[model samples]
Target: MFRKSLDDLLNWKNSKTRKPLIIRGARQVGKTWLMKEFGKTHYEKAAYINFDNNERMESLFNGNLDIERIITALQIETGVKIGTQNTLIIFDEVQEVPRALTSLKYFCENASEYHIIAAGSLLGVALHPGTSFPVGKVEFLDLYPLNFLEFLSAMGNDELVELLKSKDFSLITTFKGKYIDLLKQYYYIGGMPAVVASFIEDADYEKVRQLQKEILMAYEQDFSKHAPNEAVPRIRMLWSSTPAQLAKENRKFIYGLIRQGARVKEYELAMTWLIDCGLIYRISRVT
Candidate 1:
């Protein structure tokens, strides 16, 4: 799949004073896939590491911030030769290891030739006021779910996507039926990579819904595991109520939809948590 962010990645790769890159997005938004894809396409070699629960990787960055030593340890861990050449190093779930995130600063200063990209799911929550963030040492790209043009490309409708991009009103009008059908399918399928990929393979609505349900279940599990215990129930309630709220003609996130007389303050933290997790998108109305 072609992510718009790939262009940004290329620009960063070719920049004279490029820092390490951080690809931030909500869970299951294809962050890892995009990073790996970029590496495969552009770099001669890539070393990818995930810091989520690996104690050893955490321990590796636990001590010093020396750029050369850190790079050596990373090569040993991944067994991939990484140098200042055409190599990309990916740190997946770097928020799990704050020191690994901190090391980006040294990477930026001491060894600017090495290319690094890090991504995390709950990075927004991880960078608390007291945390040690590499403020000016990294470039960031936010990846969202596949947009309409990407979705079309994924579905083998590249020509239609090109036509839409060209803004040829007459051509677009002639093929309005095809575009309308694709639009309806896009709405029904949504943009989660897994769901869209599944739909592409089978074109089965039942299977698409099943995969979407699995994604929801995984997200709920993540909430239960990652969210604060005090706000877990409220988060579940607020998130679960989204479908019903949107089922109405107007999709306002009214507090009452969560429960009887649900005050804004009651679920504010939960709403914010969901937003940070990238599960729900809230758009404010224009005054």
Candidate 2:
């Protein structure tokens, strides 16, 4: 899979003063895979540590913030040599351990020579409630579902992507049938990497829908798994209402839609949770 974000990664690698980088995206949007790919291609060796359910790693950070001690522990855990210049350290699912999220600050300040990329599906949502964020200590790259052109490229329609880039309306209009057909496919497939790859290889609409449904299920599972217990129901409510919310002509989120006589005050946290998880897209009305 050719990711457009590879260009951004390359640019970051070439920068003189780079901080720890965070790749933010919805779950299953290939954040982890992209980080691994970049590391494999660019670095001599990569040290990958997933903080989710790693008890040893959780304990490793409870002690002092000694850079060498941390490095030693990381080398033992990942079995990869950690060098300042040639090794890329990836912290996956860092939100599970709050201290791991905060460790980026120390890495930024004391170990600036090391290249680190951290990512978590719920990292944005985790910042709420008592979670302290490492503000101004890391750079971020936001990844979204493949846009229209990327969708075309992934489907082996490179010529169509080239045509869109050219912006020649006359030529585009000449190929309206082809573009419309592909656009409809994108609407149904919706650009999740697994769904798109399946459609590309098999051209199966049923399989595509199945993949999308599975992704949606995984997102719901994440709500209960990662969100606070009190906020879980509210999050699920807001999430379930997203299709209806977008289906309406007035797309602004309405609290009442979630329940009978629902008030914004009641579901604000739910809205925030959905946004934090990248489960729904929000467009605010601007007067």
Candidate 3:
């Protein structure tokens, strides 16, 4: 899908002082695909390790975090020979194994030559209370859904993208109708990779709406599963009320909209949780 982040990955690889890389994003924003794609095109080989529901990985990381021993286990699990050069090591859902995340510190300090990229859907909420993170020892890349230009490219409008990039308003004006049509499509698809891909294949508006609903349902399930138990109900309430809140003329968050007499103190955590999960953005009015 031609992510612009691939270019950033290349720069990270070429940096003389590169550290282990961590990609952070919300679920279904294509973190896994981006990491694998980066590895496939940029390295001699890629060793992929998904920590989700893998007992072997859970057991391997539960013990000592000796860098050598961990490398051997990764090679055995991924069936790719471990190397210090020309290999991209991927740690998918590293939050599933907190120790695996802490081990990135060791990788950065000791086995600096090996290229590693790690990602997790719930990194913001999944870590245990005291799990050590590799602060400052590793680099990070924040990924987002495809923007308008990338979305244009994905829809096989590369020439249109090039024309826009050229900044020739006269030339671009000739195709205003085409651009406006595409803008409407992009608005409906809204940059979610799965939704956009489905639209690309089937071009069905009904199917696009279905996919979006499913994604929202998955997120609601995540709230119950991962969010603090006390905040689940409030989160759901705040989330479901968002559209109505935005629909108002003022367009500012009002506690009253969530429920009758709801106060900031009552729903702050719920709002914060949504923001942390990247499910919603909070834009404050300028003072």
Candidate 4:
């Protein structure tokens, strides 16, 4: 799939003052794919390290974070020779290892020549309370569900995308019917990468709906497994109410929609947790 972020990664690679990059997004938004794709296309080699459920990785980061030693260990792990100029070191599921997350700081301060990009689905929600994040020592990119143009590209309409991009209203008007049909499809598909991919392969609306439900199920599972115990019920309630909330004429967040008499103070933590997880966006009204 074509991702606009690939261009961003390229720019980061060439930047004179680039820091270790971190990609943050909700699960299933293609963070893992984007990181690997960036490396495969742009770098001579990619040292991909996934920190999920790997005790070896956990132990590596748990020890002293010597940048040289870590680089050597990663070379061994990925069987890719590490090089400052041509290697892309990827830390996948990095939040699973807090010290690994912290190590970005040392990479920035001590080994700025190397290219490093890290991503975690739950980076916003799962950092251990005391973990020292590499604040200001790393750059962050937030990936999101594919937008309309990316969706069109994935559907093999690159020329159409270019036509729209050029803003040639006279030529675009000739294809208005096709564009409207695609717009309707985009509405139903709605840009979730996995779901969109399935629709592309099968052109099955039922299957697309099924995939969306599965994504929602995974999110509910995250709420149970990662959210605080006290907030689980509220989180579930808030999530369940989202569809109805969007259905409202004004499409504004109303605490009372979750349940009668619900208030911001009572559910703010739940709301905040969802926003941090990238599952929802909060738009504040400008006074």
Highest lDDT scorer: 4
Compose the digit string of candidate 2's lDDT tens values, residues 14-73.
Answer: 898899998999998988889999999999999999987899998988677688899999
Report, for every candidate in turn, its global Cα lDDT versus the true structure.
0.88, 0.86, 0.92, 0.93
Model 3 — TM-score against the truth? 0.97
Per residue, candidate 4 scores C-alpha lDDT tens digits across 185-277 of 999988889999999999999999999889989999999889999999999999999999999999778888899999899998998999999
Better of 1 and 2 by TM-score: 1
Residue-level lDDT of model 1, residues 1-287, one tens digit each, is 77788899999999998999988887788999998999999999999999979898888888888887888899999999997968999999998888898899898888989999999987876554566789988988888889999998999999998898899999999999999999999999988898888887888999998988887898888877788899999999998899899899987778898999999999989999888877777899998
Model 1 spans with C-alpha error above 4 angstroms? 126-130
Q: Which 10-residue window of candidate 4 scores lowest in summed lDDT?
A: 250-259
Clashing pairs in 3: none
Better of 2 and 4 by TM-score: 4
Clash pairs, candidate 1, are none
TM-score, candidate number 1 = 0.94
Q: Clashes in each model (backbone N, CA, C under 3 Å)?
A: 0, 0, 0, 0
Q: Point out where model 3 deviates above 4 Å.
A: none
Give the lDDT ranking, best first.
4, 3, 1, 2
Error of 2 at 58 (Å): 1.8
